[model samples]
Target chain A: MRTALCSLLDIEHPIVGFTPSEHVAAAISRAGGLGVLGCVRFNDPAELDEALTWLDGNTDGRPYGVDVVMPTRVPTEGTAADLDKLIPAGHRDFVESTLTKLGVPPLPDDDSPARDGVLGWLHSVARSHVEVALAHRPRLIANALGPPPPDVIEQAHAHGLVVAALAGRAAHARAQVASGVDLVVAQGYEAGGHTGEIASMVLVPEVVDEVGGSVPVLAAGGIGCGRQIAAALALGAAGVWMGSCWLTTEEYVIGTAMPALREALLAAGSSDTVRSRIYSGKPARLLRNRWTGAWEESGAPAPLPMPLQNLLVSEAHRRLMESGDPSVVPMPVGQIVGRMNDVRPVADVMATLVAEAGETLKRLGELHP
Target chain B: MRTALCSLLDIEHPIVGFTPSEHVAAAISRAGGLGVLGCVRFNDPAELDEALTWLDGNTDGRPYGVDVVMPTRVPTEGTAADLDKLIPAGHRDFVESTLTKLGVPPLPDDDSPARDGVLGWLHSVARSHVEVALAHRPRLIANALGPPPPDVIEQAHAHGLVVAALAGRAAHARAQVASGVDLVVAQGYEAGGHTGEIASMVLVPEVVDEVGGSVPVLAAGGIGCGRQIAAALALGAAGVWMGSCWLTTEEYVIGTAMPALREALLAAGSSDTVRSRIYSGKPARLLRNRWTGAWEESGAPAPLPMPLQNLLVSEAHRRLMESGDPSVVPMPVGQIVGRMNDVRPVADVMATLVAEAGETLKRLGELHP
Candidate 1:
């Protein structure tokens, strides 16, 4: 685990965990790996500020990172209200009809204004996230989609923070490196959230060969255990960036509307997930259920692009989550869900990964003999 | 490079080349790596026998192998003529109209019966390939589509020949191992010909973890260079099985109707190919061309199942090759085509792979220190 990445990030192990929970991130940082908090869910800057403030006080002064979803292609321009008008009536009808037909109930009548302006795919919304994250003493900031803007990278560097960008293609990795990103997270198709068509095995080595000389690459997608970490290093990746595996961690299990998220993942197999655009208007891998199937089956309308699609399904997702139906929950997960069969603590997961990878390396060392 | 595969296969290098040419296979075997001849092209048993006889005389007693496509799911049963009738008239019209619109000329008149009986996907045709290959003193016999039939595996083993099968999924690998396969080639999505959606990076380790203890696993798909071979080994592959890289060799460059195959491959990048069922009714990766575009564009008819789809486009491919048009040539290649940029001999390619892999291993060895 003591590779260049260990020294670069000043972490004991070359493993980076991505999660939305502050507790999981703190636990991972305390366990000697970099814990990156996914800040897209924090629509309000104050919420992100409070989360970062908590992270700053915790983790025994260890460094953590923040991930923002800043897609290169903004399908629509203007405010969220203006974007809402662009979503077609037919698409809205289909989403509502499908959810209603599936018997999904609506959320309880609470006075929260439906999370209107905080859609993370909006550049303006994500920019606020960067602002909130920089207010804290985090060491790294990663853009979830494509290369971050040149100014964003410069701003992060000016603040003494490393700027990392996720690339699903070798060309994207090269573009990110050219834009002065300090690190490239080469994500594969098997990964959750947004992804390209290329798989991790081919994408990692291709990106490593393309831009690895200039910037370190973190192998992502379907990375759950220690042997995969070893494999990533063999592919010339500096480390492994894992997100889906942490979703089932005990820290993540503590909060959230759906306690069945971990149970759904445990029950799923590698082929049980589908890459569909219904989640966020991008081809993201998610658990195959009525939602994904309805969007793909015959007579289903083509999903609206970007922010429009995300808006159409956001309320439905809220309802499904509140309903607590594991089958309909909007869980973004990777194919690695097939391997995450247990509910363990972050420390136990990290220890097992490190030990298994150490043993795998020792076994590989004996291959020649 | 000195893994158990070398001793098990009695080869100096744990690299295997898959090619349709007898010359390339013999050249590869003589260069210290096993060369598996793809027998799907030989519709007649006599043609395969003739090819094997030539290999026997040329290889200096080195071990070689044969590969036949025996798909688990047969789209339609019956003879080629019987299956030819099953192809819809609309698909035939589309193929003819698309090719004519592209201005592809007809094949030069030769006295052969237009190759009507030898559809590769048909099990009856593939079984003849097996019968012909068994008559030769080959070291291994591999089934391309799925696990070989029980009788096929039993027969191959009884002759002291190693039985191998390709798998794109972990479950497929496990099934192949359970069916008594001596080796499982984990072909990823980036591979040429037929492939699954799982990328080699994630798929290799998954398949390796699933079946490596039961039998050896060979990593295939996007493996064109030595560094890739090193990565494959790092992913726990016993050896590397490559197909697309050999398509650009000098031997392949000669005696092929389309002299531009190598040029096309050299001009291609990793993203230049697509996985479409237009070629074989199964989602096989191919260099994107006018043919692939015509089938996928708006108003295009959905491609029929296996033999029917293969039948729909066979004549058009023949005419394209005979006309020497690169745009319509049916070249099944992997994403590694981007890395294959030269016209070298089989021996030089093998030597460079061995040397490059050695250097990569040494470089990785320094990563810890």
Candidate 2:
């Protein structure tokens, strides 16, 4: 399964595991694949720095990556309080009313800051994520939405870090490569969270053709098992970037903190997810649950654009998670949830992927032999 | 390039080319692959009988197949006239007004029966198609929606014809296998025309896991080039079933009859299509154009159910074709349209697919060796 990606990323396997949990990320790096910790959930810079420091120690001297979300077009810069005021009153009311209708209990009053309004999706916060990541020993910095700003790319290069960007279209991949990204993750429509309308089978090759020679392409979306990884390689991708498959991994923070969500994902089928804008005001794939269904009802308010939509639903998302009801919680997962049928340690998953890919490649080789 | 599908279907390559033209079907069969002629476009039994007769003589004694559209559940049986009457007046007006707005001119008066109301989607019409196919020498009979009815399956088996069905979900494949289907075409969301929401990468392995040992699985959707065919095999499919890839083949009817439509397809990219119910009451992927755009506008009437919706838009489709304008014509195609950039003979396409798959397999083989 070795490819140019293994040499470039300094990993044993050509698989890149993406998860928001620092624990899962470290385990993946230790297991011989690149583990990219998603930094968008860390609204506070100090928290991201702490997580990266933990990863640096736990990875046993192996390389890991950090991913941040920054829109291709820089959004309006504003403070959390300023952005909060921009959310419409009606949108807030709709969220409150929907939560009440669904009987989602509110968070218990505590001194801890509410984990609402994931301000990390904003450009400024994501820039800070890059700043924190550069101070660590990570080897890669990935932009989830588009190419990192040129200055950020230059800074990462100065620190000898590879800068990769996720693209849903061939044009986007071309744009990312032109902007000096080291690698392109061709994330398809079937991927979790924000994605373009092209599926992996078509998108990977298109992206590969667009930028494979300049920058190795990593196929993503609906890729869970080793067969998919082999297929990705056949489609000209240098590697596979997987996310939703890790949601059920033992090291995933959600597996223990949100047992119901993990179970729901394990029990879901490919069709159980839907692409909708309710999650982030941008089109994204999410588990088809009560939250999405409510937003879909006739006369329901249309999701506001990006930051506003995420802000509007952030509290409701928090309440739904507190409710601990799997059917109502908003979870961003890919169609590959159908294949994540059970919990496994990151090492075990990595082993299975490597073994299965080897077997698949051997069988494919026999066809031509 | 060989698989169980090749042995079962008596073809040299594990590739199935699906097209509506008898000429294309015969060409594919002659090129060492199974060519399944889509029978849904033929409303008149005599016409289909003639087409099959032409295929019988033109395929150079090579094996071929016929595909018919039959919903899993039987709908109300009626003459085409009765079905046309069932279409709402407002739906008719909406179609008429939209066509007028798009400047699609009316067809010139001709003795050729109006090609409106594709009642072939109904059970009775599809059954008639099966009867016509059985009278011919096709090696296989496939139902597009689900398993052929039990009697039809028995009839096809009695006639020594293989029974195949297209399935979008694992359960659908299970059902088709249970109903004695010899093969399952796991059509994914990125496929042309009518399809399920699951993409081929997720759906193929799921279906293979469900019924591969019992019945061979053919991967469909988002498959155009040879690399995709190789990837399909990697995903555990016995072969690849392609539809949209054939639309630009020289033998396809639209190439000569509607050059603009063919040109539009050649120019399209992976993101140029959208899945909408406006094409047929059921959701089908169609080339995004003025027709689909009009249906999506505010205050536009919801598409009626399958038969009624087809009946409603049938005349509008006729007018769009007559207008010789590609931008307003309704063409059911897949995301793979992005790769169909040229016109070639069916033999050339098949040759390219085989050569590409062979190269891909050889390269993949080296990885493990």
Candidate 3:
């Protein structure tokens, strides 16, 4: 009844459910697996505190983790002499003109959020969010892009929390382990949010071989079933970390537009979705749409760096969120959307995946050994 | 500066590629555009000889094509299926043993003078090939995956010919498409054969839009690349037809690995890659490898099928091609691998994807209000 992964994380199953909502995270934990709350959008310190408080009250003492976006490169992390001096105005203008052509209207008069530039916003939110998450005793903290910043990692270990980071390739996995991360997640493109080019089938094994078990690799991206969960362990993964499968669950708060788009995705071939910075300045896969079309218009300007470009598109996203229009909105999702076909409770979803994987393993075990 | 793809086929550009290597038939032909070749390992007399002769020799040498398996697949489709199928049962052991325990042997004594199946000995010979080339008159035939099937499409089209087939995705522009095809290529996972899954990177347009006026659509597996290709044409595509991109890649080929594997696959994510052949009966991008490893074991049964499974792997496949060792055999080649990284070549490979699409038509003086 025990899985190597469950043993690794001291849980009933090695499943780590990834969701942007605190409710789903707590529910998964209560269901006897780890719940990872996505914190990429938690731009304020107070919000992190509130989410943790909510999770604490709801989980009834179950374990959970938190995820944050600590990208490979922070625009502001470069010393004044590093990038600020090297990148020129022409590049910046080229970016401006590009967004302008894409119908990126000027910042509206009613909003005054994050006046901070790209570098400033990244630094501020990343720092405050990590600090806030640490305040609560989350079992793990995963950095969506890279290993947690050194300071963050130092603080987490000091508090007995394990640190994990997402890696899109073999090289990235090596870097993550060298940074002393507790786990390395080799995320396949099928994952929601941001991911890389390799498939889970190939990437996971390559990473396991590369990391050589120095760190446990929890496979991420498109892992939604028992068979896949079994395969990950067969491929040497200690656990399976998922995101999209949770999107349509009852505990997920995805709105009408997203749910509708997600439904349409069920009929699509896996290749139908695309990864474009049009959603965030960095590439993240989502359903293709007209808003992406306009921004991607042939010679459209380059998207500005992370937070700035994200800031510009945030308005379009807000409008779409408000209007529920599929035509001009950026739906943050992954190739795994094709698999999130039904609405189930987070607990049911977890149980089904684990149960299925166990059956698959048993069947495999029945085979010639 | 012109490619045989353009000059020979008389298409706007030389980007012709990814056609099934059948004897050339459609609901009929010239859908106004053309489809080339990908990874096809099987060949009956009617198909190999007839398909090539017709695609290249007929069409007024207009610009149609044929593709053969690279020197890999059956290495020598000429292997004796009858005798090979008679191998002892012990050789088919993997079916009775665990994969980790299978003892894959070294390469066999490959002294045969056959031209087809696997290593493509037929292609390595130039005389029988030159005569074959002269037999057909096609425009442009290419050689990759170890030189296109001999007599290639170009040799015939010269009597008038326009031929092209699939290539590796990394070669999307620089290598695969750059050298020349009258057309270019950018295939994604939804494809068959051995493939890598990196969502077309908006690759269709990157290649289509980037290679502007150079080639047209021939989109591959996932050509069910659909409204997306509508976007492709918006990005610019002459036409679109797909292969595994369609299970019935024209419907002629469908096999047993059906139902369970297929259903399992439907429930699978883009992250899935079954190097096991729930299909090839061997283990290909199948549901799992347990079945495949069962065959690769040292004392397992022999493999059957094209070129005789190339070795003794299973009762079904094992009886077909066991010369001694298939572990030393060549693997299949299809452009779609699973998504190890999220490049989404679909709409986002390059910035010029759409604009240049406009520019391409503009330069061609084909614009409309």
Candidate 4:
């Protein structure tokens, strides 16, 4: 019932669910663990504010977090005024051409998505959002890319918000700790988006070793069960960060197409998931399907820089959602899909995971002579 | 120019170097694309000797084939007359102690200068050795377990042979794969080693995929290079049949590490290495190492059944060279690794791959534009 993770977040469970949907985020937070919304896709601070406002009503004061990717070095964030100047003609041309091929119509005029947004590449734009987001009463702020900039962490600390950064490898966790983030998430390759080489098992303990308890470590990637959550704690992770598991839940507003794709993947007990920059510019785990397949074919232009690629895919993402064709689509999830059997409600899933983990721990205790 | 794999046998190259050694099987064959070895470590087999031997000395004796295994099914070909009647008491006692303690002696046998005949796992046995190797006049028979199987494939095919296997994700080429083999080798995780999830760019396509395609798909993990192999074929793979590249490789080593590691894997990168024995009773790749570590640390009986638990790492294969040491390790090879960067080894690893393949008229090529 009690865990160090819960103590860190002041919640009942160490399960921190990462998602882009406000509905799912609120449900997870209300269920128990904090729900951190992925901020890579949000372009405007107002939009994030709206989502947070909705989350506020849904969570009823439960703790939640915001995840932003603050990459090591971003080109788009070059200067105060010349942010868009750095993108080259060829890259821009490639983006335009890619969108045409994917069938996503061009961005609408005044109704179009913002032109200056970072497109999930961890640009200066993401940092701006972080500043605006910290003003809210959210419990945590996580950097999904590299460590949060010193200013962001300092400001967050100043604002009384716990800071976290996602690490795919152990060294990254150490980097997060040294950078002064309050927590480090050991995100495994099984995770939905950007991740490092190490698995949760190897990665968690390694991160634990590297951080040496200076910061609480949350095990991300394939943590979808009570036993898995318990395992994260057992391996020294203060919390378990889950993403895909929540996407299939009842509250998720995403179409059945994506979940159906995930279900097909679940049946195979694994996925043909490969990390490609075809969707978002950075390497993110996605089901291996036609879009990625197209990128993989010979003579294809190598994916361009972050925001550019995101720019290219954004229209297509909308079109595909409208079309509901999975052959040309990818449902981004973690390797945990294999273990994520049937669909379950967020509350039931959380309860099952916790109860099963308790039993596993008890069984584990019984193992001792 | 002649090869046991090509003009003689039915394959396309004269280079036949079969190995459990990730580096050798990958290196030599990738070098010439004539590599064909054992898949036992990856999964169980149905008397591979016939197929292996059929491949032997075929390239008018250019060289070919490696025979391997974790062990067997039905009554194991070795041990007591009756199956269940045979649990060696001392062995059982040792296993019980080891399992209960969750302990394994450090690589003492490895450090020992006279570690001879200690026989790791099972490949050390003579009865099983001749059973397979003698059947094939392999250009080479790579035995990854230990002291190359007695009378190795080269000897049966009448010498002037090339025998090799791999060693280490750790140290570089040593008195290792070369001592028993004609070629000296080393495969980092970049290689698809025993579930090989190492890096080839770092490993190879470093060693060969590493320093020179001029070296050889004889290139490992991330190989089948044209530009890369053109970089590795230029570096090396006179011929290559890289297993994982072949699992996706134009061949079949299917159902081996599938259910255990690759099948359960969320993302398919050389980075997802979970060397656990939940498969083949050895610690192979079954997702992240953490998954297996749980079953391992559980108070279960130290795994049993060859290819059976060989898939789980829960037990050790008794009569097989691939088992033992706290449990059989997963027998997987790396894909060209990242250097596998591309997936066209069958065609790209060699200039010959395309031209020769083009000439074959397999009824399928006519369809390609």
DockQ per candidate: 0.45, 0.81, 0.02, 0.03
Stretches of model 3 off by over 4 angstroms after superposition: A77-121, A254-269, B1-369
lDDT (10s digit) by residue, model 3, range A202-229: 4676687789568888888667666566
My TM-score estimates for the predictions, one after another, are 0.96, 0.98, 0.52, 0.53
Q: What are the per-residue Cα lDDT tens digits for candidate 4 across B71-169?
A: 212224332223324444543454446444544333334432211211223443433544555555554444443335435544633644454545433
**Residue A155, model 1: Cα distance from true site in angstroms:** 1.7
The CAPRI classification for model 3 reads as: incorrect
Instruction: Give model 3's TM-score versus the native structure.
Output: 0.52
Instruction: Identify the leading candidate in terms of lDDT.
Output: 2
Sort by TM-score, top down from the best: 2, 1, 4, 3
Best by TM-score: 2
- Give the per-residue lDDT of model 4 (tens digit) for A301-326: 77767666665555566555444554
Cα deviation at B346, candidate 3, in Å, is: 36
Those runs of model 1 whose alpha carbons end farther than 4 Å from true positions after fitting are A115-118, B115-118
The digit string of per-residue lDDT tens for model 3 on B1-369 reads 122334335654222334443322221134323444332433343334555665554444455444444443424333445435554555444333433244433233573333223322234332243344445543444443423443343454455544344433434444433444444445545344544454332234334545546554344433332222222232234433344322222322333333322333334333343343323333234323334545445555544543334334323332112322223122232223222122222113122222333333232222111
Candidate 2: residue A261 lDDT (0-100)? 87
Q: Locate the minimum summed-lDDT window of 10 residues in model 4 chain B.
A: B360-369
TM-score of candidate 4 to 2 decimals: 0.53
For residue A147, give model 2's deviation from the true position in Å.
Answer: 0.6
| Model 4 chain A lDDT-worst window of ten | A360-369
| lDDT for each residue of candidate 1 in A1-369, tens digit (9 for 90 to 100) | 588788888888899899989899999999999999998887778988998999999898888999998889865766667778888888889888988888888666874665363377788888999988888998899999988888888899999998999998899889889999999999988898888877776778889989999989999997887778877887789999999999888888533564756667778877778889888777899888777888888889887788777777777877766666678777788888778888899999999998877766665555532
